[model samples]
Target: MSGVTLSNVVKKYGETQVIHGVELTVDPGEFCVFVGPSGCGKSTLLRMIAGLEETSAGEIRIGTRDVTRLDPAQRGVAMVFQTYALYPHMSVAENMGFGLKMNGHPKAEIREKVAKASSILHLDDYLHRKPKALSGGQRQRVAIGRAIVRGPEVFLFDEPLSNLDAELRVEMRVEIARLHREIGATMIYVTHDQVEAMTLADKIVVLRGGRVEQVGAPLDLYREPDNLFVAGFIGSPAMNLLPAHPTEGGIHVPALGPEVIACRPPGHVSELVAGFRPQSLRIGAGDTHSVEMTEALGGVSFIHCARDGQPKLVIETKGNHVERPGTDISVHVDPDEMFLFDKLTGHRLR
Candidate 1:
């Protein structure tokens, strides 16, 4: 029962259905992440599981109990929100132990739990400090420590690290990853950030417009997406999609050139979109393109290129230099690295 389950879950506000039938299960002690762009219903799903919002239909179960209609406190889950939601007036220790104190636990026990969580989160040095007195990352740790002190069966994080600066966000991401391992508590995290999902999730659920796109391991979604949405949404810099016409044995990408490259769709490929990761788009001798612009990251580089009269294409590189824009050049893509989707369904051709 330490795990969570949603059976055909649906949510609505008046006439508008925000969540479609969503059937989901989180294995005990599993770290599951729900990721999507803004307004994709990822947060709504998390809140529903936290018992904050009512389900218009379907059932929600937590730890073997049907908690669909239960109060938030009765769900045996603790949530860390994007806002941190800390008590400005209370010190770290008091803030963390407040729930236990309100629930009428013994003073000594509440203090003990707060101390243990603070120790775990390394909040001991700031136990007496208030929220405003802490740095962004420190306050976030306090918020997580508060959730930890609850000792709930499941932890729900709703973009808890979104407010942090980029550098701190990565730091907190690693901390949360380590925390999940240390506690071994089942976690359901929601984020618009793909990096977080990729790094933290034992399983990642890619949601779109209230429906579940696909759920799988981080690399599984990256390497093999079931639909165009999942394919484009799961990776960094996003996957590059180049429309093509289906040919006898392969696809003819007129945008790239006149050649009809011979290749087979991934297993089960049918009506869907064609796709390729930027890293799969290669340029060098034998393969060429007109470089529109070049961006260099410390560890990698990207060339924004296109054919003589084609739309811009993105290619990843670390050492290659790009030519200027408006120049005609040849280019090639790896058949194994390429992706194809049904023209009509937007589902992966394979």
Candidate 2:
């Protein structure tokens, strides 16, 4: 397995720059995910690494070899795209071994490699079937198997599971995770879904507007975000950010109650933003807020509360309890669970 390194990597289209100077390293056998909102340049960066897009400035190295100017074929990287991109007329075995065949490998070698890949992806029984005969998930496995036969130093997946249904997507996530463990190859995956990034990545690169906001382990980014962007983007329902004012000993949060939350703020800061995850809050007694909606999903429920001018707050609770719309309620927040940020710059106040 070989690691991938990027130093001051940049991309541009004529006079407009899409990918800023990005510096990242994917350790050998690491599953690194690039996650962000749409049009955030996550796909652009992945294409640059795969040699599909030219780097305007900087260097890209796979292990020790600088692949900045190398062709995709020469970079020793295989990419699996959102679409299966399979030949309808060709059998699964043929699709898997096509790259090697075109490169002039012997028939025996091609068949051997295809068989091995098929076994690994559990596509051995479907080798004789054409792309049209297989299901979406099986076709995706064929696409993945094609990459495996090449034995590339790095595997690049650009939203490979986007085309699948919800059930298939979950199943394929497990398959991809298992494949990574069994092959132990350096893989770079790009997705806009934070849930996918959180579950699949060993390291996640969060990007926005062509710039990296943070890079760290999944839980690390979730528990300790660097700024407001990360704090809001990394979570499912997102962290609740309420407008606040700095007080003598703590911060005054109007959304929670009239009382000041017991948390220290920087002396220089005046305006503050307080963050609270839905799970950190609970429904208490009193009618300070009104329930806007309630989403009861089997074992858990999310209650959306609203006030006159305050930001909406989502309170996550256990069980199938549902609150009626316009029902008066009070939200209780623990001072220790609050995350303070500077309202002006959107930076965490720590």
Candidate 3:
């Protein structure tokens, strides 16, 4: 397994620059994910590493070789796209070994590789089935098996689960995670879904507006985000950011209550934004806000609360407790659990 490295990588289409100077390194046998909103340069950067996109500037190295100007085939990387892209006419085994066949490999070698890949992906039973005869998940597994047969140094997945239903997506996620563990191959996955990023990545690169906002392990990014964007984007349902003002001894949050939260702010900061995860908040004893909605998902519930002129807040509660719409309630959050950001620059106060 070979590590992938990007040094000040840049991409541009004539005068339009989409990917700015990006610096990243995926350790050998590491599962790295590039995650962000739509129009962010995650996919573009992945394509650059795969040699699918031209690198306008900077160096890209696979292991020690500079592959910046190399073709996709020469980069020792295999990409699985969002679509299965299977040939309707070919059997699963045929599809998996087609690349080797096209490249002049002997039939015996193709069969051996295909067999091994099929076993690894649990596609042994469906090897003779055509794409039309298989389920969406099985088709995707075939696509993955095709890449596995190549034995590339790196595996690149471009939202390969986007086409699957929710149940199939979860099932495929487990399969992909298992595949990574078994093969120990360097994998760079691109997805706009934070849930996938959180569950699949050993390291995640959060990108936005053609630049990287932050990069770290999943829990590290979740527990301590670098900025407002990351703090809001990393968590499910997102962090609740409310307008706040620094007072003499603490910060005053208008949405929560009139009581000032005892948290120190930077000396020069005037306007501040306070962040709290839904799980960190609770329904307290006063009528500070009205319940707007409740999403009860069996064992857990998310109560959406709102107040006039204040940003809506979602509070996560356990059990089957449901808050009625228009029900008056107060939200409480510990000051220690609160995240502070400068409203002007959107930078963390830490």
1-350 in candidate 1: lDDT tens per residue?
Answer: 29999999999999999999999999999999999999999999999999899999999999789999999999999999999888898999999999898989999999899988988788889999888899999999998998998899999999998888999999999999999888899999999999899999999999999999998999999988998889888888888877777677877776666777788634454444567788887665644466677777757888787766766677788764555656555677787777887767776655
TM-score of 2: 0.99
Question: How displaced is residue 98 in candidate 1, in Å?
Answer: 1.2
Residue 289, candidate 1: alpha-carbon lDDT: 64
**Model 2 superposed RMSD (Cα):** 0.9
| Backbone collisions counted per model | 13, 0, 0
Q: Each candidate's root-mean-square deviation in Å?
A: 2.2, 0.9, 0.8
Q: For candidate 3, lDDT tens digit of each residue in 228-256?
A: 99999998889999999899789998988
Looking at model 2, the pairs that clash are: none
Output the better candidate (1/3) by TM-score.
Answer: 3
Name the runs in model 1 displaced over 4 angstroms.
264-272, 286-288, 320-329
Could you give candidate 2's per-residue lDDT for residues 1-350 as a string of tens digits?
Answer: 89999999999999999988999999999999999999999999999999999999999999999999999999999999999999999999999999999999999999999999999999989999999999999999999999999999999999999999999999999999999999999999999999999999999999999999999999999999989999999988899988899886888888887877776667988888889999999898999999999999989999999878888999999999899999999988888898888889988887
The true-structure Cα RMSD of candidate 1 reads 2.2
Clashing pairs in 3: none
Worst 10 residues of 1 by lDDT: 265-274
